[model samples]
Target: MSAQKRLVWPDVAKGISILGVVLLHIGIGVPEGESTWLYQLNTWLDPLRMPLFFVVSGYFSTKVLQFTLRDVLVKRVWFFLVPYIIWVSIELWTKNLEWQWVFGNEPLTWRELGLNLVLGHNMGWFLHALIMFNLALVAVRKLHPALAMLLSFTPILLLPLNEHIFFIGKALMYLPLFFAGVYFRQAITAFVDAVCRLNVPALMFAVITYAVGFFSRDLWNQFTGEVVLPWYLPGMDYMGSQEVLLLVRFVEQTFQLPMALVMAVAIARIPYVSSFFAFIGRNTLPVYLGHPIALTVGYHYVQIVGQWEISMDGERLVNTTWFWTFVCIILSGAGGLMLWSISKVPGIGWTVYPPSLRQLQEMVMRPPVLRSEPCRD
Candidate 1:
């Protein structure tokens, strides 16, 4: 396949993943009864959503591996770290302001704030973990490829450390996926192509597996009054024994990974859908950065309109329906576009989205000087 053609499916996959991420976040905020269709839909997608994103990210990280360590660092600084720090600072500031004004709570301590930033607290953790994963991948690949493969399992052993220290826990959880992308990029592409060729049967199988896994979790959660599966959501914390944790992780990986890949392949095969997703995928950074800001703005608007309320059960409630879910998605996309538009401005663009190193070089480099003798000649 040509280079451009090869990129189409991956971009489509990425677009689908980012949209899923936004949808998942929307699901997170809006609590629903277990019987609701929206609830089940969210439940079904929960496992596949973030894992697919990490896998896609990992697949792309292969390109980064070719760069020198200095170049890699520079890339991360402008593309990842700078944006991470700036947006994180803004998020923290806004969150604190919300706490004080809305909830009348004391502000976070300097130490607490510093730790959160360092740890990449909340939604920004993905970028933090990604930076670490890339750095680790670079270090490991310096050894033999086989040895590097072996090192990928180091995170699995540290599964207990998941969600513990700064980005370490999350990094460990997703590192294998990232490394899988790096090492098995060709294999994965072949697998996706093969699956895509199977067409209807492949898509059906993917859907069936996802539904089965979703309902299986729902059944377990219904019986236990808690989600027994290993889901990394806010309220669904895993406090089980080591043995249980291991089992949950096993079940989750086994079910989630295949479903995510299958769904990605299925989505990539659809012409119009793939193009839409590819567009979103190509511009994901801005979407990822700006969606939270958009959501916050929408939240305040709802609040002002008396549409936001706290449920008696202490669950935060907004007057939301399926219609509003679509609205939120549109708003989120709009937010990303707005940020992207702002990024085109001359002086202040870097604050929203950092400039590429090539762009920076072009901006800073002086024009070549022509010698006087050459001019005379």
Candidate 2:
């Protein structure tokens, strides 16, 4: 395979991640009683979604240590930070607007918004995590790569801080996976390549592996009293301690990684499916940044639908729960893509391709590069 073809799977995986995220958020607006399918689907794929994205991101960042500190900071760190600041601001403003409109009260003040931005208390948290992880990697670059990976897990020791500093806890949770991508890039690539050429039996084994991981998780959840277990397994009503839950989560994600790779390669083998998702994957920056805004607005409409009472033969009717749920999902994905298109215009492009204050000035003074796109990697 050509280099480009070989590289297509990560983009395809990213396409899946962004879409799964959008689906999860859209499902949140659905009424609990009516959300069974959405809930189950999102829950089953949870391990694959963000984990795959982070691993791919880490794989791309494998060379960060080789770059000058300034280049890493300016080009990569600032690249994500600038957008995180701008969009988190927009997210806060729109949320404040919603609170005022819906409840006739503004719960978030300018002070609170500023604090949230600093702490990253919003959906744009993935970007915030990217900033911290990159900085963390830079700080440890002088250490042996394995030692750095080991140190990344030390963040888990700060589980207590999770209650107050949510983003820190989350970044710590995924940091090891990011490090894995950095140190194990060769092994991961070879594994993915091998999976892509799988025959039917091998493919079935891959599917069975994924199914076993998810099913075993279901059994674990039952053991922890989170869900029902198999009849043969004794029903142990154990409320899992925090440490145990964390361990299980890591274990499940470990099982999920290879399956996600296999699935991505499987998708890439199909021509049109590969092209469509890979396009989204390449443009994931806009989708990931814009989808929350779209979903938030979409949720406002969904809430309005929930309150909708139609008079049918002088009786009240409040149906269409599933209908609206599907609608919101479709529209949210479309809206995010629409924002992606809007971001192509020069001046407004900064909404997606946000530059630091210095880069902003330089970008304006210089003419655009001919075929330049944002670094999808």
Candidate 3:
């Protein structure tokens, strides 16, 4: 398959996973196991979203195989960095008013602020470490294929051995996985194609994942106080933070990646569902940026109306956590899509710009109809 064609599942998966990622952060509680089994689904899903995102991202970057050091840095740095910095800067400007009390840390001075604006911090670390991975790859871009593969994982492996630069660690840490996606781009594509061919199996996998995720949440809650899953979000704990050991991460990542891929592929197979979800997938950046704005504004309004009680876990405000959870998903997706579309115009692009090529291309380039499912991954 062509390099461009090799990415369909991952692209779709990327959109799906981001939603999962945002939901985890937005939801106060893990939907592990409540009285009903439904919540465990996200638990199962929760693990996979971020890893596949990184892998698919890695898979595609490696697939393009067209990047130069300069080309890689400019786009990777600017594309991710620019928005991350700008958004976090906005968060800082806004005092991250919602989360300020939730996660208070050292304040940024003018100099410190400017430095981090460049260096990136907190949730913005994805861009910072990603830039590192891209720049590191520049050295091997022209090297023999085998050598490049070996080199990619170097940064990822060295991560566990370090105690500092936790933010920078993910760069090299996931590089191998990224390159692995690229390397096995063919294999992954083939596997996905095969999975797509077996509709029953794919759907079964999706349903089972949903159940698995739901159950796991129950399992985790039953044991979280003692289980020490240890992979808590960065800075959320006092152990100063450390990357998950490689082997454990491998076990955990496999479940989530496959869960995400199967879900994306299964969704792609359906018509009405595919179109609606794919629209969300393609316009991912907007949903990512704008939803928080909505969440922030809405959270404040809740307080003013004397309804100041919004549970991150929806159990308190609604009939059930599931109801509000779905609401969060829809609002996040719509908020992102609307804001992204608005940002596409010249002046407003900075707020929630579409990825330039596809958004423009999609306007004129019709999304092909999937007849009996396309063969590419």
- lDDT values of the candidates? 0.68, 0.75, 0.58
lDDT over C-alpha atoms for residue 335 of model 2? 71
Cα lDDT of model 2 by residue, 1-377, tens digit: 34666689999999999888877776666555235577578777888998899998999998887776786887788778767888778877777777777778757777887788778788888888888888888888889987898998886556555557787557665889888889899888777766766656556666776777677667667873443322222233332355356656776776778888887888987989999889889988778777777766766645654566322122333445565566677777777777687778878777677657676678689986699678896
TM-score of each: 0.78, 0.82, 0.68
Candidate 3 or 2, higher lDDT:
2
Candidate 2 residue runs with Cα over 4 Å from true position: 33-39, 101-107, 199-216, 224-243, 301-306, 309-318, 355-377
- Cα lDDT, model 3, residue 120: 47
Question: Pick by TM-score: which candidate is best?
Answer: 2
- Model 3 TM-score relative to the real fold: 0.68
lDDT of 1: 0.68
For model 1, the superposed segments whose C-alpha errors exceed 4 Å read 1-5, 31-36, 108-111, 156-163, 199-247, 304-327, 358-377
Q: Give one digit per residue, the lDDT tens place, for model 1 in 1-377.
A: 34555677677767766776777676665433333465577666667666677788888888766777777787764578877877766667666766676778788777877788777775777787788777887777667767886797675554445446535445555677778878888877766665756756656766676666666555555544432446363433554543244444434653566668876666766788877888888888788878877766665445545645433243333443554555677778887897788789978788766778787889789688787764563
Could you tell me which residue pairs clash in candidate 2? none
Candidate 3 wrong stretches, greater than 4 Å: 1-8, 29-39, 99-108, 112-120, 156-164, 199-247, 255-259, 304-331, 354-377
Q: Which residue pairs of candidate 1 clash?
A: none
Pick the winner on TM-score between candidates 1 and 2.
2
Q: Pick the candidate with the highest lDDT.
A: 2
Superior by lDDT: candidate 1 or candidate 3: 1
